[model samples]
Target chain A: MHRLILLLALFGYLPAFTQYKPLDASTINRIKEGVAEAARTTNTISSDFTQEKEMTILKDRILTSGKFFFKKEQQLRWEYTHPFSYTIVIRDDEITIRDEGEVRSFNTQANRVFAEVNRIIIGSVRGTLLDDTGFKASYTQSNGNYIVRLTPLLVTLQESLQEIVIYFSKADFTVDKLELFEPAGDFTRITFSTKKLNQPLSNEIFSLY
Target chain B: MRSFLFTSIGLLLLLSGCQSIPPRHLTPVSHHLPSDTFLPTAHCTLPTFFSPPTFQRALFKASMDIREHHLTGLLFIKMIPQLRSSRCDNDTVSLPAYRIVCSNELGMTYFDLEVAPGVFRLNYCFEPLNKNALWRILETDFRLLLSPEAGTTPIKTFVQEESNYLVCKSKQGGISRWDLYSPMGDTLLEVRGKSSLADPSWISYAEYHREFPFRINISNPLIKLKLSLSLLSLN
Candidate 1:
């Protein structure tokens, strides 16, 4: 009877302890290999982006169309061409935003929030999102797409963002959609279409105006 | 020594009592109008008008530095008969539209278009004042207190007095009063009233500076919107 009671207690606590156990060595190696393969396969990423922002105060949702350009070694540019003209370029550790004729630049290291955003964007582009220790990731296969759901580990991030869901094409593992949900019931859904991978891109494309 | 100490303490207490005495209250002047008549119509009309010869339409552009937020934008306005008209075809224009018609006798404004598409109708009646008074009223009341309408009427007006003043009340509960000086005060424009139908009870105010046409100060009881408008000439 004593042995049975001890066994039952141990079984009850085993599930909780196993919840955060490290991924198996083989799984970790597979993820790294997949990331390396994706990085090498994708030299330049160009895609048409459609962003929908649902504002909390306004009943209407704003639809914006833009183009996204990305190159290896963390160079990205988001150029909005319709509805209004705005461009956000991230090169190295600096971000420059140009709207109309005005230009504003800020360093990622100086702005912690922007730095985190840069890291997440870079990680997502490189298929290394699973390496971010600040989030717990679970993958699901849906409609020939890999859906990665990231839940924030920190309370502050969790308060602002409930979850970030990223969808990548299963055929080539290219990110096609990213949905961010804010705690205030607001959401931003960005969809990528006509994605061209491994295109030749010049460094001048990321130059600030 | 005991006698001397008691006398000093009594004198100190008396002095403290004199210092703590309440200030004399005087009866305030009864400037409130009777229940039947809230606003006085004595100085109902403005004195005169300063008519410029030609009406020019130009695209105005400016950059605003609003604290830390900067904005730039362009506005196209046409100086019409007695009113400054703006094109309302674009949904980007944020303010209301009004048709301002000024004649020798009175100045009339038509508010809330679409019922009578672009038709000018009599709205507010401004009695004629002198050119100086008109300039003062324009600077103080019309230019500053009123918002530049894109499709709505300017409803509120102000008349400046020494310290105490009378204000006409709008049916929507907005108050209009004019100042004694220029049409555009230190601040080019000032708008004070509830802007939206949702919050009819709340009072909001906006101030625009002539020097910085791109910057605006908007404040309500709850929040403040310091908007900067930067204009990039697409031309």
Candidate 2:
């Protein structure tokens, strides 16, 4: 009787141990496959975006509305229409800013601060951030949506960026929102609307003034 | 040619007479001094209030044309003494990314560039003014230089050397010469300078035309920027 009771206790504890086990190898492989699929599906993206910057130090926030275009292989353009007319274009690691006939060009590799910002922006549009080797990502399912939380592994990147949370629709895997939190108590939240994916975006669109 | 020579000789003698007056000794009088009565004594005592006396809380609209850049825009300026006291409330439709502030006291303005993340300050001179070491020359006999009422004794009188020149001498040992001609001489708007004696001296002179608004120019040799101002409206 004593031996039977010990056997029953051991058998009951096995299920709990299996329940607490870490995500299996197959589960890890599935996340990688999903990320790769998302990247392949997005070739070109064009959208009308509204950028709102809220400075933690000031009471008033600045709002800017513009049209953004991105093509695979690193071509991007942002044109602001209201409150001012300004254009910024990125082509082959060069950023061009044209404001009221004053044009300035800066090479990405020359400015380290700007280069980091550009990398994040380009990676987001290309869906390459999902596979960013500098960060570790985990997906959580909540409210019928998939939330990907990315934590930087490198010290410098971690100093500037605490984490980046991306929300996507689970059914179609379409990105809807992104939140980037800086270590210095500042954060930028961007929500996308009127998004057109896999559109026929021309290379000339990025080059036009 | 013979008649012209006679006239020239006679004019030279008259000018010499004007400059030869003997200096007179009179007690320095401050009652009629513009420096004594014009600006409030409290303002001068409290050095921090060193801003323009007029248009402290007024609204102004003007058109700015930058000749170098060939850029023209309509600018609206609102000055409020309370709340946003330090900055000029400006709204420009053309350059939507920035706000501009024009100082009435300092006679300077700055552009707050928001979108591009920068700031640019532009200096304007409305009248010729000096604010550094040069202002000392004006205060040596401030009571006499700026007095609206000329004293009783005309210690010296100026007679025209020619149709275009006059010389005058004061009892306190000051001399002035005036040249009158439309083509040969351009009437300058104002002269400004800083006092040689004061620690931080700024002086301004404004020349007003009978029909049009006045011109003001400011020079600060110590500072690199010079300013010019055109009166858009008197009110």
Q: Which has the greatest TM-score?
A: 1
lDDT of 1 at B208: 26
TM-scores, one per candidate: 0.49, 0.44
| Global CA lDDT computed for model 1 | 0.49
Native contacts retained by candidate 2:
0.00
Candidate 1 docking quality: incorrect, acceptable, medium or high: incorrect
Candidate 1's C-alpha runs over 4 A off are: A1-35, A55-59, B1-156, B159-189, B192-225, B229-235
DockQ, Cα level, model 1: 0.02
lDDT (10s digit) by residue, model 1, range B38-144: 44343322211111222222222323232343333332223333233456654342232322222110001111111012332333222212233223222222222
lDDT of 2 by residue, A1-209 (tens): 99999999999898766543444457546655665676678877777766553333323233456777778888878776643466778887897766556676778786443465567677765567777898898766555456678888888567556787777665556566666665533455666668788889877787644
